[model samples]
Target chain A: MHQAIAILDSGVGGLTVAKEVMRQLPQEEIVYFGDTGRAPYGPRAPDEVLKFTEQIVEYLLQFQPKMIVIACNTATAIALKHVRSQVNIPVVGVIQPGSRAAIKATKTGMIGVIGTENTVTSGAYPRALQELNPDTSVVSLACPALVPLVEKRLYRSDMARTVVSQSLQPLLNSPIDCLILGCTHYPFLAQMIAETVGPRVSIISSADETAREISTLLHHRGQLETSGKVPVHRFFCSGDPETFQAIALEWLGEQIKVSPVFWQMTRLSR
Target chain B: MHQAIAILDSGVGGLTVAKEVMRQLPQEEIVYFGDTGRAPYGPRAPDEVLKFTEQIVEYLLQFQPKMIVIACNTATAIALKHVRSQVNIPVVGVIQPGSRAAIKATKTGMIGVIGTENTVTSGAYPRALQELNPDTSVVSLACPALVPLVEKRLYRSDMARTVVSQSLQPLLNSPIDCLILGCTHYPFLAQMIAETVGPRVSIISSADETAREISTLLHHRGQLETSGKVPVHRFFCSGDPETFQAIALEWLGEQIKVSPVFWQMTRLSR
Candidate 1:
């Protein structure tokens, strides 16, 4: 079986990026693994995220995917470097892709990054942005509540908007012209953030940039799926499969069938 | 710090019960811990739920509560027995309280139980109800999607209502005069369920019964707060405090300030 591109995240947040990949690469089959069992990797220690990321990647490798996308900001922050080294396939994280997109889009060299606490604290985006443009100034904020708020489908609620406004106030105060949603889940709340920051700030979801990166990596490696076979995306979670499927349908629409893969940790070998 | 009643659940579904406790015992202070970080304990292995429940209990003990309420059906199904023996403070799980209430309300001696897959699979309620009255007939249905539906706040959505109605159709075929919302989170979806089941079947929330049990246990143990103290209700989560607080206000209302506790693992163990 030809392994498709494998995308892994701590939870449903990665679906935003996965959806983007599907839209861009309709011919490429995808396998998505969401570690919904132990999610919100934002608050966990970096070591734990590394451990969790490794487990999921190893699980996905059984499918022999051509590439892997670490579609979580927290994992990208702490585990991407280690993960890339461990996996035989090329592993891409969203942070650098998003940072590059923001740097290119920002005219004033003022960029903003918003994600979970762990992602912001890691200074992953600022470092990546600075690497691209040393003179660029980056403002990063941790919108911890935004993910759950989106999970609750409270994006349109005034209360949710108010909370987003309050959380993004500091970032809005800066002279940033481009705001990077450092976390894949953050894009779900992009409308609220965009509304709060006004129209001047361009909101860039890492999901889009990551998809582009996947396409680029696959193209460069000459590993793009060319069989013209109909793509089927498979989803698995360590938590509730039915629940994960329901949320996936809601976020990705009802057209797709996201099945649950019950993952059991058999053995962890380095 | 004066100790208050501490209630722990897998997620915000327990807020329905916490709100009732607040309403019934206005003078008593309440502290809530929702493992929104890792919720929907229904399908998880019994041992996993038990471990998570104990961890939360241990965390809540730092507040030095006189008693603990396991406001989660999955937790109650497996952990209550072990939890009771482990804690010096009386620990009351929702299952027995809910079962007793359903048995009392059912004039037809026919009862219905709706919970997560694991909860129903455990046959805990069937055994408990039978122990109370061998003549009583019980119908149990595993609502795997109910938690996610509740989490998304789509209780009233046509899709959610349709799912609930379909899942409950089997129980509707029975002669149950009273239906137990076996999972604490199920109560939030109560209004939709009540409407679906119509006016015939009485719907009982484990949260309410658990609150009542807490009141009774407190009185019996001489731990009930009698100073008419308008206690400050504090909220904590292992995940995002902002998301937890947002859901708290959404479900229970914005009348109270939901504050975040800095989560330090070592600090929690104290």
Candidate 2:
């Protein structure tokens, strides 16, 4: 029997990471939980995120997820430490995998990080970058509007380009060889960001790196799912199941069997 | 020659209508334009929504659509008159068909219209209802968060239910035999809204009625493209093209090809 991995995020941004894990770990049955109701965790407070994360983990544990991947940077930064202490299973956050990838990719030692305002304020990426490579210089900017923009399905247009340029104006002056898309949603806007920031700056996606990290950790810990014939990936959103499934099929390039699940808080209230 | 119909919206909600149109008219081609960059027109100022509508219509005219559908209620209310005066093609807004359907469905002649804040604020549905049946009572409520909540993909969660409940609280007191889902996005939340509003209220969807209207109009005008082997439906989003294509396939429910196009401001840019 193959072990199941539970991946949770505030919303669809984590799907990027989950898809990558599916590609790398073929045998594991992946369960995804997206908190679409209070998504874009960047602006949210730490305690709120911690509580949300706990609820998701507990929900996923009912299915016996062998490991829990906090696929969101904002939640991982604030909640992972506390979550690790409580859960018996292994927990992984995107910051370290992304930080390692950025440290390795940058030749100029100067990297640019674009994330939500709260994620930048958290100083999570900068700290991880510095810890990995002390001499590395990081220029971080919070794109306050980008997440909402992307969430609304706006990634093309002069307006989208204008917003991208405006958000990235400060980072342009720095000589950075690599740009880290600190938010998972940032990758969807990679084309506009790349055009504005110039092609020389390599765009690093945390989704890819985090997926790789999950596989390596599972292998080392002897928790890897080694058997399964055609694993099924189930996606549950606290939002529109159709839209989530649609975007997942597009992003994952697979006919994902997505079904609607009702999160009955009233039942839990009893 | 099969004439192409121009379907425009502030964003992806219109795709629901467009998908229906494609299903109903197989031989006819559709040119869908979503102003994804600055979407959720329902909450936007009437003037801004008007400007957006005009811009998209002007852009779509280059494709020479036989008719244009203002798939957005906010845009339809604000700009339908202006668009009709300027364009030679027949203009259809989701409002009239939906209002007509609600009026016909209601036994007590009390109709409730639920849509975005701007749509309800503009009194579009009320005006449409009164124009069709002067004696009918109209109750309108602004569902400000529903569009964004749906756009973010949170349709089936406790949070979604809570939001739906709160938004519909205003309508619960009013006696309505028929409830009109005035926005295209509203249909995605139909099941939940119906469950909350109870089984007594007959839920009216604008998309289905709008599709029927287009069929009738095209048939009367001799623009119906019948006897073709298969109809081609082309979807273009000012966002992630691949993502749009995937969601379209799921919504479209048939093996139809979806292609991407750049929303260029100028001819030279394209």
Candidate 3:
């Protein structure tokens, strides 16, 4: 029973980060929470998102997690600092890791970001990127249309490609060599995004980069699991457990137990 | 004045890291030390490498650097922990960063490592890889020939291509999807190395990855330089200043001022 990394996301969008964490650090146990009942926190107001994130963190504290990852882009942009102030443990957000990665990957000094309405409006990507390298030119697009499609499990549909193409048209004209998938949900549509963006621009999955940084932070803290034991992952979602279970299975590419889970998360109300 | 990242290597190998730091964090200043007189610490005794690395750190401490990067793999394998005990600031080593990157990139779980004699013999890569993931399969090959070519600036010669092919012959057959350029110098021959190993393997440059982690560490510590002023980098070499300057200019692809230097490093005598 290793002290797990507690990861909280608005919905299955963060399944991308969880999948990478599972692949990259196989021995570490994961306790993931997806607030699918309030799925697509992107278009929501900042204070509401922050309150919801705080509720999830409070719920996860019962596990005595060694670290907390705000895996949802919208949630990370809104509540990362607030969450860090609340917890004594290491709190990692999806923003800075993606920003650092884009800074590493970009050759043109111009970078592109596509996220939710809340994330883009918060101006987190530009602030994060420029904070690391002030000279970086950031072009941000709010893909408010994409996350709902993912939450609804329509990311594989032809409509996803259509929405993705139409939404990305403004950015294709820019001279960015590296595009940071500012939203975690975007990696689910990565293939369609890549084909639309062409071969020159590199597509950076913030979720994957965040997973790599989690390994870095854990390594520096000397908390990396050295055990040979296979980890049994636990997942909790606030919405339809069946829909969550279906999404988790398809995205994580494995059997993830998400049953016997009551959606009583509203009890931790503000 | 922004505190600089102090980088030390056994000749120009760590220039790969320094170059990346400059490129990725353009605003951050760098203080680089190249112990060219004691070049190729690869085949040296671990005690000797450790002693030499300590001497460089002692000399670098005069500048009050915020971070000390043991950019040389051989020296890092010998001295990272010991140096961390001596310095209050963060001490970064190249090995773990590369190991983490390889883990992230490797789909087959079979990873390859190519480094100098000391780094290979230290079993650092395997330990680092397995520490993060107990299931990772690591195959390490010590390419003692690559570093010397880089030291002599012969990395571009036809000899380099032939030597790279001959040296990497044992690894080509391994079912590895990612090859960690374990030695900082190996990136100099990365082109030939990549060609010889074919496109099946993703080349993981520890030097570049180490620079990326340096940013992550600084960001977490809230020490990333925010001033818009351009950074003036300093270079010092214990051996011939002229040869060191020549290699610096070529490797860094920028004008590096290395002059008015007396080779009195023996003053930090044991």
Q: Identify the candidate with maximal DockQ.
A: 3
If candidate 1 were superposed on the true structure by all CA atoms, what would the RMSD be?
Answer: 26.6
TM-score of chain B of 2: 0.92
* Candidate 1: tens digits of C-alpha lDDT, residues A12-36: 8899988776655556788898877
lDDT of 3 by residue, B1-270 (tens): 579899999888999999999888888999989888888999998998998898889988998999999999999999999999998999999999999999998888999999998899999999999888888899999999998898888989999999999999999789999999999998889999999999999999999999999999988888989898888889888888887888888988877887423544666342
- Model 1 chain B: ten consecutive residues of lowest lDDT: B260-269
Q: Report clash pairs, candidate 2.
A: A239-B153, A239-B154, A239-B155, A240-B153, A240-B154, A240-B155
Give residue B117's lDDT in candidate 2 (0 to 100): 83
Model 1: per-residue lDDT, tens digit, B1-270? 457888888878878878877654555678888887677787787877888888889888988887788888888888988988898887777887677667656778888999999889989999767654556788998989999877656665889888888888777667789899999888777888898788889998877767656654454344656454556887776555666666677777765555544563345435
TM-score of chain A of each: 0.93, 0.92, 0.97
What candidate 1 gets wrong by more than 4 Å, as runs, is A259-270, B1-270
Better of 2 and 3 by lDDT: 3
True contacts kept of 2: 0.00
Which residue pairs in candidate 1 collide?
A: none
What is the per-residue lDDT of model 2 for residues A225-260, given as tens digits with 9 covering 90 to 100? 654466777887776677677677777887777654
- The candidate maximizing TM-score is 3
On the 0 to 100 scale, the lDDT of residue B270 in model 3 is: 29
